[model samples]
Target: MIIITKNAKKYFNYLLNKKKIGTQIYLFINNPGTQFAECGISYYNNKQFSNDNIRIKYDNLFIYINKNHIIYFKNSKIDVIKNELELQLILKVPNAKKKIIKKNKILKNKIINVLNNIINPQLKQHNGYVFLIDITTNKDIILEFKGNCNGCSMSNITLKEIIEKKIKKLFPEINNVLDFRYYKKK
Candidate 1:
């Protein structure tokens, strides 16, 4: 899970509220998959949220990460960097290229175990169960809803508050826990 420093959070909230709808902050590698890679931040409002991006919300701030960028960003933190010339928000991905955990098997299995043991049991009472579809290239978990869970009015609530929170707690290495049905390519 990404951490926004308190100072950065305050500043980001101010900037985010001022932007028009659809605005999102992006953290990316200037030169990916290399020793020369450096992480940077920028803001734009264009494409709507889709399967290709991992949407992260910290309070009112919305950050969008391209699915391919997840491994590079897993352990990163966002902070405000201020100097005499300029002040800005930055993504700090230490050991950027050297530590990409691609398609982590152990973490994926842990997620499945949690779902079966804790989550599905609760959902089973409601005649619902969730299935792990796949771990995306970015390492985000993609889940497919089944039984009562599929097309349930409260599915979003379950995905965000319960399912997502549980997965993030168990595997911080994952970027975003996304429902497969939510993707609408644009």
Candidate 2:
């Protein structure tokens, strides 16, 4: 559920009455359910208008939010803060930073998730990153290295000792892990 505080309602009224804008505003979220989630407010242009947009009325104005975005807005509160000379809109969405995972996720997605959430952090320390490229019929995992690891002489050792071991350990079905730039399949 979303709550628009009294002060926030007043600010919305001010925006319509004093600013002479339309009676509609759009609530948006970018990269929802991730560590980098962000909430924003935007005005819809004529071309962007659609009757399908779900809206909630707040006396003087209406907030249009996509139905799918409601998940991130659960337990969300919209408020306003009055500073020295400015009124700032505050959006507190507690669930926005939580990662959403489905039970029936594919093997590729599962592997990518582990690489992104686990292995990439350690690689980032050395100014490098690795990502899955392909999974062969033989269950061989192909990975691409970037940044510092791309041309480094130690990449082969790193792949054998660190990346390969980790991938195989996490997903035991995986046969071999090969670096894309270094390993060319015949």
Candidate 3:
């Protein structure tokens, strides 16, 4: 949900009159949940509304939000600020760059537990270990290597052969198991 300031709502109405079609506004986020996330506002047309979007009636205008991008827009605010004779549309989106909660936490933790119980024991033999760093939305696993395995060239073989194979066996839904890269120890 987003809050439209009094001035912002007026500004939106101003834009609606200029549009040739529907009196609707669209809020969008590009590459959300990462460093490069960008939030934007645009004029929306009635013809574009579908199951992919959720609509909310705000005063005189309707707003549409993409169902997949709602997480980043939650609790956001839109305001029109005048500075140095210039009017700027400011978007205050907290969850855009900072995510509130991960998508699939239960599966992530389960993968970690599986790795900790089955994989770490063998890795500990080499004074090395692999732990889950993140689970991407695509179900690919991100892992970090520690101890002797951190800089070992054989780590790639361990990842693709042992780790990836075992995880794919347990969770057939998983796509890739990637190793997180960190600087070598001094």
Candidate 4:
């Protein structure tokens, strides 16, 4: 979501319309957290910079703002203060920062395709199904082993040696695999 202040709207529109060969503008809104408050307007051309909680990709020439940022600026008004020396976004709704998971659709579909075709087919003989629970940037693939494989004694070995190895071999990008099958608690 683009939060354009009344004062900055004109300039922002200009930037969006008259972007040069290699220039991109990104606005970052800080979330309310225990540690600190930090936000800035980032200017990029052709490089990627990532901080602790944010990442900017200049090649795309687009700012993929997070949900938290949007929520933070939802009730805020943007204005140019003090003869254009400073730009400010005033928050009308306090405590509006909400954290939410943002999923990459293309990557997710790619993972699901691989799982359905490769993993599930292989496990069909055991009446097992490989359900992908989640995928992380760290390349950890979380899966739930269902059917006969769920409570099997050798499930751990199957997951670690067989399933994990197969998945890693197929998708070299994955770093680790975790099985999240539900078992009776002792």
Best by lDDT: 3
Query: What are the TM-scores, per candidate, against the unseen true structure?
Result: 0.49, 0.49, 0.54, 0.46
Clash pairs (backbone) in predicted model 4? none
Q: What digit string (tens of lDDT, one per residue) describes model 3 on residues 1-186?
A: 789998998988887888886658888988888889998988778786789999878888788989878878889999999999877889899999875565477788789899899999999999999988888778888899999999899999999999999999999999999888831231
Q: Number of clashes in model 2?
A: 0
lDDT at 32, model 1: 69
**lDDT (10s digit) by residue, model 4, range 45-126:** 5355444334433333354344446545444444445545654433343324444344554566777898798778878888
User: lDDT per model, in order?
Assistant: 0.80, 0.81, 0.87, 0.61
What's model 3's overall lDDT? 0.87
Off by over 4 Å in 4: 1-3, 6-103, 181-186
lDDT of 1 at 140: 76
Per-residue alpha-carbon lDDT of model 1 for 1-186, expressed as tens digits? Answer: 678899898887778788887777877676666788878777857565567777777887778778777777766888898989976877778656774555466667778899999999999999999988888778778898899899999999999999999888878778887888885341
Candidate 3 vs candidate 4: the lDDT winner is: 3
Lowest lDDT sum, 10 consecutive residues, model 1, at: 95-104
Q: Which candidate number would show the highest TM-score if scored against the true structure?
A: 3
Q: In candidate 2, what are the lDDT values of residues 103-172, reduced to their tens digit?
A: 3237789989998998889889989989888888788888999988787888898889988888888888
In the order shown, the candidates' Cα RMSDs to the true structure are 12.9, 11.0, 10.5, 12.7
